[model samples]
Target: MGRKINFIVLTGLVLVCLLLGTEYQYLETAQGIDSGDTAWMIVASAFVLLMTPGLAFFYGGMVTKKSVISTMLQSFVALGVISVLWVVVGFSLAFGDSVYGIIGNPFTYFNFNNVTVSPNPAFSETIPFLIFALFQLKFAIITPALITGSFAERIRFRSYILFMVLFSLFIYSPLAHMTWHPDGLLRKLGVLDFAGGTVVHMSAGIAALAGAIYLGKRKEPIERPANIPFVILGTGLLWFGWFGFNAGSALGANTDAVIAFANTNLASAASMITWIFFDRMQHRKMSALGACIGAIVGLVAITPAAGFVTIGQSVFIGFVAAVVSNLAIRWHERTEIDDTLDVFPSHGVGGMVGMLLTGVFAKDVGLVYGETKTFIYHLLALCVVAVVTFFGSLLLYKITDLLLRMRVREDQEHRGLDASQHGEHLL
Candidate 1:
């Protein structure tokens, strides 16, 4: 009886195995690959890519006409330089394996090996990893471009090139590594800069402050800004491109991206209305220029928190940010900082506000969604980043000056960077 039972069981096992093999083959034949996620990332990358030119115009219009083209060109040129560097080494350093809580290791992956479409395991499982690196390159390109506005029309172009090359390898790459990488020092420390508040704005802002101080004041008080109409056009592009900046940060075509998109608009609209009121209250008039500036300020402040906060919360945050940033810019004018184009006030101060505000408003804190920090964590992160970036940039400026004796000559400042550096004049 025992032998007969064993024989029946062995026969049944063989038949079950055969059925399982047939089903596996059928499933494979029925299903195919999906590319929806890939398409989204490509479109998102293109949108973020245009922001550099938009930035050129934004910073350019704020300078004297003679230096306007030069300021704008600086932004334009960085795009070409950073784009190549990004594909070659910048991406590897940013997304590579973390080394004792410092920078990344670059030897791994198809990166720098002259191969296209090497997959990264870091960003998202569904999206092609190359898409991940490309999206971030856009952010890296714009951060330093934004800083050019601070030292616009004054710094020598040759010095500027050296500064950018070093800035990308040393300053930008390491900060991005620490902030965004899964194993970065700041990320492990629980700093949540969703869309580059610390990495892009805080770093750029503090860097701008250091450059403003190191370069010394402009030869004359920034000739009361030229071309208000041009300023208006640039502001429009800034507002439009900012949608890509905040929304594409979602990285997926899902509900989170939609919420981020909506919040961006809410914050900017609220900022505009509130700023107009503030101007009317203080100066007894409503100015178009003030409204445009206020809207941009609001846009900057909401960036870090756009995907994390509510629409109502964004409205309040935007209003307060505009008021505070406006006050800061005015205060800066009174001081000796002389931040040309107000880069420090608008992007720097506004970003700081958004970073801290993200802590107050960041909603979910599930294991998958990442750690949820209260306000204290955000403040601590902000303080550490601000101090480090300020000193880091100051040291860089001193080193460059010591070696090359950089910074534009006084006569060049009087003549403008456009005429002196580029040998062209703005219309």
Candidate 2:
């Protein structure tokens, strides 16, 4: 009876918060809202939202049947968890009034307070501020979901949830604030991330490495993927959604969006071809898995430079990133650390390659344009992000472990996370 009462009270409190957010209004009027830009942004936001489900299939098809359900759930659950957190506080911490150029003042937009239907010049001058906030929310959702692949099949579901919350609060919000906020430290320093090479992919990839190390190796031997068809299907969806992911960052239906859209497809194609070629050289056969991974590496590599570089430069970035990530995966295999899906090699290395290449190839400000200042700033920002994400992730993992044991027991692992953790089975 007491437990039921507590649950009721908690539910009531949540309802009240929602009510307050809905009734709230900002009286400020935005100038020159464009219908075309608004329409494009709405579609783009939906496109970005779809990537989480696409990622579910991408990781789901790679794990054993016994863990398939659990693996996919990690990505699916983030849509719900992060979405609510974003409306409540995550958005404020990321884009609210800037505090010392490091983070947003959480109270400025708490529970969606003052997030107006009219445009905010700080983010987008032509779209509703609410729409811009929602668009950014999708990016936040996927960033943590990206980490699940590293610890799949071994993480306790409850502990994983707790860790996701912590990671979102401590690691993701600050990075997003520092990179995307108008007055952010990195932004002020002239460190350019056209999409999210550093903020999303690099942070997720490095955290994946930390999670894999902290959890140690899985006791069970790695097995062949249960379903390649799912992987292919996922790859297709991710590729489709990426158009919005890259182009939508432009915040308008403009030339930059068009350029980003074209560059996205070009880079992905080049990377896929290069990856298969490498496979043919090493194994004498092209592979579907190789093609999909190569395509994803290309997408990841081009994300940061999508709007800044030309189609030709994007192709070059894709090819180079594929080569580097493929080698990183090979090197990772030899190490004692077990990163289940090679998230770090593919995302971490790919994002780094994109960031560096952006400094070299970006229009007007690139090293190729005889400007070294932008390149030097990018290098400095890369080191800062890499160091902060690494140590911060390591600390978060430790704290999560202390509060809730991160690893499942041996018997639970043998039974698999789906059946043991959630009482479900894939096959």
Candidate 3:
């Protein structure tokens, strides 16, 4: 049955690609394109793409040795799955014509029909619209990859692929539309997400929580990181790629990008330092794992405010977010909910902190600047996003499970997902 289903899907995808082949002829570079900006954006897109494999390492190293291969593949597969999906209809569903400010018309840029090399002034005037779409594609890819951590080691690989597609289409695209699109509901309401604190990190984190809850506990919930060194390597790659993640959102080689770059570094540094010291204060050892997690939390917290807040404010945001998320992890340990790798504590809570602080410290519009409206809107948007992502993800998980069982069999769980699901194991 699974083989038949895979064959049918593959056949349909091939037909769709053939039908869309003519659309590629429309691709042409337009005048008024800035070479420098275009170069930077291309590099930025590549940098963002690298983060996915980096994520694979980051996640793989955190799971037990028996599950390492399966865990890493979960993140790695998104590169193939989401890239194709985005080109097919995911990009349109995100950046296409706004449909009532909540979603995009799927036909607006169907199969890259009008997504040409010409700059779309609405997105970025200096770079090709195709580049813009691809840049956003990287974000779409990573969001679902991030969720795999919550259910790692026990999820059936095929079931997860289905869930990833559903999550990207239903959850990720709409949120991207509502947060980043010019006609987006939240954007019009004065919400300021310079990067993806809300759209990517928050949505992934919240959805991760739903997944962990829906999937329940792994049969063996014990965690013994497979390789701490891989965690360090992944952290380094993520930190390096994040400059593009935050600064590239500026859409140009401009002052805002420079400011964002500086803020990104400062926040991560402060959070890393704060996290280790905070552990010391609690009589815990300052392990390298903690440092890596702390740096990531800082990155998540700083994302939304990177281009909007001052350097000093970014550091403060990182400091506050690290302490809060560290506390969140400790609190989570008390619950029966098993979120492998603590995705909710790190990305979810960190994103929330960043979103709220962006409201407080955003230039000229923050609470500290005496403007109440933006801050109020941010609070409201945060609630809306949380409710939408959590419940929506729960629904998607249910639907996916109904279509195909989501979890592995008990024996398979005991044997580890790498060998059971993929028929392969790490050396």
1-427: candidate 2 lDDT, tens digit per residue: 4356447647955885666657766666667889999999999999999999999999999988889999999999999888888888899999988999988999999888888879888888899998999999999999999999999989988778778988998889989999999999999988889989999999999999999999999998558997989899989989998999999999999999999999999999999999999978888479898999999999999999999999899999999999999999999999998999999999999999999999999999999999999999999999999999999999999998887788999999999999998999875
Clashes of each: 0, 0, 0
**Decoy 2 TM-score against native:** 0.96
lDDT of 1 by residue, 1-427 (tens): 4345346646755664453343212122212212665677778788777778878877776778788888888888888778766765787787777887667776543233421253344666556566777888899898889889888878887677657766787788888998888899888877777677778887888899889998988777665677677677877877887777788788777677788888889999988898889878887578777888788888888888888888998998898888888888879989988788888998889889888777777776422246555566778888988888889888888876765556778888888888888888766
Segments of candidate 3 deviating more than 4 angstroms = 26-29
Ranking by lDDT: 3, 2, 1
Pitting candidate 1 against candidate 2, the one with the higher TM-score is 2
Ranking by TM-score: 3, 2, 1
Looking at model 2, the pairs that clash are none
Question: Model 3, range 322-425, lDDT digits (tens) per residue?
Answer: 99999999999999998998999999999999999999999999999999999999999999999999999999999999887899999999999989999998
Q: Name the runs in model 1 displaced over 4 angstroms.
A: 1-34, 109-111, 114-119, 365-373
Task: Find the candidate with the highest TM-score and give its number.
Answer: 3
Per-model TM-score, in order, reads 0.87, 0.96, 0.98
Candidate 3 clashing pairs, residues 3+ apart or interchain: none
Global lDDT of each model? 0.77, 0.91, 0.93
